[model samples]
Target: MVQQWDIVKIIGAIALPQMGGWVNGYLTRQEIKGWYQNLNFPSFRPPNWIFAPVWTSLYAGMGYASYLVWRDGGGFSGIAQGPLFLYGTQLALNWAWTPIFFKRHELKWSFVELAALTATVAATGFAFFNINKLAGYVFIPYFAWCSFATLLNYKIYKLNPESTATIEEVKEPKKKTN
Candidate 1:
């Protein structure tokens, strides 16, 4: 049987990842301030401001799903841990992606990473469904967002393969006037 403290621990573990992701996301926003403003984003791109609220809600859902799994006790037996582990792994990857894409400006690598993250999240969702239906449902928005992000990353990479440079590098150029 799972105690309340166990539930708290699971929620805490899940929240830690989400909080880290949120902070990294904020930093990425700061790093890409002007870059996003200048990009040739797709027509399907949501307004820039929409991301904050969307992510916040998604993270909340993730946290709740974790709590559910944690409270389920033996409910997490067998392959149940699969979803939880994948959930955490994908969250970590997701958090790292913003720094790679925005801070390092590695659009190509970012595209690949985002694709992997999307696949992991999809797998997590499927695994979670076997453990808890609602838990799986909670990840839908997260999976959807990653899918959209993968498309965006690919477009950005295609649009500017040679544009992979740190913000500082992009701002500086060698003089060559003859």
Candidate 2:
């Protein structure tokens, strides 16, 4: 039995991450383009087009998982606040990583943020299990993706130590065209 708030919970879950994705895209549009075109990415990198669909699906899963917990009356109303709070915290951390990495160009700190996010996700999943085991299961893929992303962030950081500089901070020597 889905309540009206259930839909809102689900939407909130997905929308929050979607908002993060939007901010990431909006703020990093040029950086993202230049990354693909210019950076020495790790060999295992996926096509840029792949990120949209993958994140969309993952966000859906996250939202559904959260909806299950929220609908079960496990959020602020029950003993589940700790877990949900962890969930919310991780989501915020997830949101901030983009700006840290792209806008501020803090690859090293971005990786640190990812590490915190990974820990938070795990705590949230474990907390979710206490309330709804199925909800805990839903986060498995999200957890996996974050783990993979941590490694990817590290690789990117290693590949482009110069990326620490914001676009304006680093000056490129101009090439003369014929």
Candidate 3:
């Protein structure tokens, strides 16, 4: 039996991360059929169909984990501040990566950003664990996914040198020597 306030908090918590994903998904959908389809991904890159479900699950889990932290740690004031701050930091980084990679086409920079995101997520997980073990446990898959994403980002960055080239450079023809 859950209280109305608890339900509201859970919904809010879950919505925040999912909203970020929705925005990022918008960016991804815009490019997936065009730019993303043509990009040079690593051999280990997962099938395109797999990403949405995995991400949805991870986001929901982390969001619930956050709610636990907020509830157990006594809201934003007191002990919740540090962990919540960490969660916020990681969420921002997570949101930033999609725009950087999908919209701006900055593969290398996105990888760098993702590496930072991975580290931040790990820190957030530890912080959440300190506050509530369940929160920390829920973060395990999120951390693992971030780690995998970071590696995938690095591999994609390496495989696609042309990703950095400007549109002008791509469209221009090279002259042949006699």
TM-score of each model, in listed order: 0.80, 0.84, 0.92
Note each model's CA RMSD in angstroms: 3.7, 4.9, 2.7
User: Number of the top candidate by TM-score?
Assistant: 3
Better of 1 and 2 by TM-score: 2
Ranking by lDDT: 3, 2, 1
lDDT of 1: 0.77
Residue 136 CA displacement from its true place in model 2, Å:
0.7
Worst 10 residues of 1 by lDDT: 70-79
Estimate the lDDT of model 3: 0.91
TM-score of model number 3:
0.92
For lDDT, candidate 1 versus 3, the one ahead is 3
Clashing pairs in 3: none
> Per-residue lDDT tens digits of candidate 1, residues 75-160?
45645466667877888887888888877778878898999999998988887777788988988988988898899788877777
Which candidate number would show the highest lDDT if scored against the true structure? 3
